[model samples]
Target: MAHMSILLLVISSLLLASTNAHDFIKYGYNGANGADKWGSLSSDFSLCSQGKQQSPININKNTTNYDSNLKQAPRNYVLTKATLINNGINIVLKYDQGAGNLTLDGKIYALTQMIWHSPSEHTIDGQSFPVELQLIHRSSDNHIAVVAILYQYGSPDAFLLQIQDELEQLAKDKCTDEQEARVPVGVVQTRALERRTRKFFRYVGSLTAPPCTEDVAWIILGKVREMTKAQAASLKAPLSAEYQSNARPAQPINGRTVQLYDELHNVKKAPSSKSD
Candidate 1:
């Protein structure tokens, strides 16, 4: 536990050493994370485009009555056991050890790196949450299962409060003009990523962004974590100029089923804009 100022300074310093925030953190499709380069980075990341998956699905969790028999498998990732490594772009994650496998519907998907997006890239129950962290895990058979969680404005969630403090301390530059920063080694944990309950919405979909790759196991939860407005603002803050809207438009479901554990919950489409 360190002071806020100290953490921010550290992040600034690390990022400044080589790249700047604009390089990866900011929006626009020229540099790393810039949607334009997603295709060239890695073949797997190619799904960033060429996908026909539904974008944001707002969760207005009303029922916990549904029961899901989530087959237990060796966790592909140990949330707390991550080693932070920034590869040119924003920050690239590398696991300290091999993630065995994650079980869902009796299928196992090997653990892959979990990354963060700004201001959230999706919505829930038509109620747009502030942020969304997509945990991408792949199975040995090349199958994929994504556990998606939306951050909202309500009672603060323990994980969000913790991660906020950790990110704020990312290596900050000594000078204001400088860019790029470093986040402490031990920042997030896999344990925290697990939903309070195994109950979730399962659907056959594609990546929300480009490449529009289809056939991804999308597991979205009705649980929305509480985060402060400041925290929400911070996510979108970095990409203000180039990508005030880091989120993409919700793709067409095209007759896809947004289902809950056993029974399916039909989530209707959300209007482009809605008032709270």
Candidate 2:
């Protein structure tokens, strides 16, 4: 019965994605058509305001409960040639089908795409990261799982640097079209997932973006990836002044329980795949 429910949810997500912007309206983080006005923007975005489980929420560790039943699933991501695009709002890297799969709760969800949000939409104890990477995956039946990895200021992050090099090119050219780039998805992604804590905060939430549908499975990693300030600035440079910070404000948890998995200890950081 549970499996059937997940399958049905996935079908709904696909249909929603197809007709999400049926009328073609612009929605953003701020201004006249900002987050606050999303529900009013159009009938399609009503969930952005009405949904009870919106994402990019603040994870208050103090109030969370540890759950040993949560599995530490492995993510087998393949290295692929992805198309990187500056959508004028955020930098998005779109991968081809069969590039990767994340096994969670005994089910495998195929990796779809990844997007960058500066100053992270989600916060920990009210603390925000310099940048956040959201890896999206979808099960064969339509259930969506989002893994949120936070990057802090420290040494340069190899994975980010690789993409950072291309960011400038796209920003300078102001290119709206996708630029082909070979990304080491396997090395970069796996390393991020195999964190020292082997821990994450899991909950049900809506998509951070509009058409904010609910029922998404969110897993936010506890470990923070390090990247130098210059690297962070390079990423934000692509956006216009107003969009320099694309992160949405942390939403309310809405009395939802956030399950934590922190049993795996002494986890070591993986070597950087900088050269790839």
Best by lDDT: 2
Residue lDDT tens for model 2, 92-195:
77775566888888889988788888999899999988899898898998888988889888988767665665666766756332332232332233344433
C-alpha displacement of 100 in model 1, angstroms? 6.1
Q: What value of lDDT does candidate 2 attain over all alpha carbons?
A: 0.75
Candidate 2's C-alpha runs over 4 A off are 1-23, 175-197, 264-276
- How much is 45 displaced in model 2, in angstroms? 0.6
lDDT of 1 by residue, 176-272 (tens): 2233344555635555555343345666775554443567787765556677777666444433244444555455555555656532232432232
Write down the RMSD of all candidates, one decimal each: 11.7, 7.4
> Which pairs clash in the backbone of model 2?
10-142
Error of model 1, residue 137, in angstroms = 0.5
RMSD of model 1 against the true structure: 11.7
- Winning candidate number (TM-score): 2
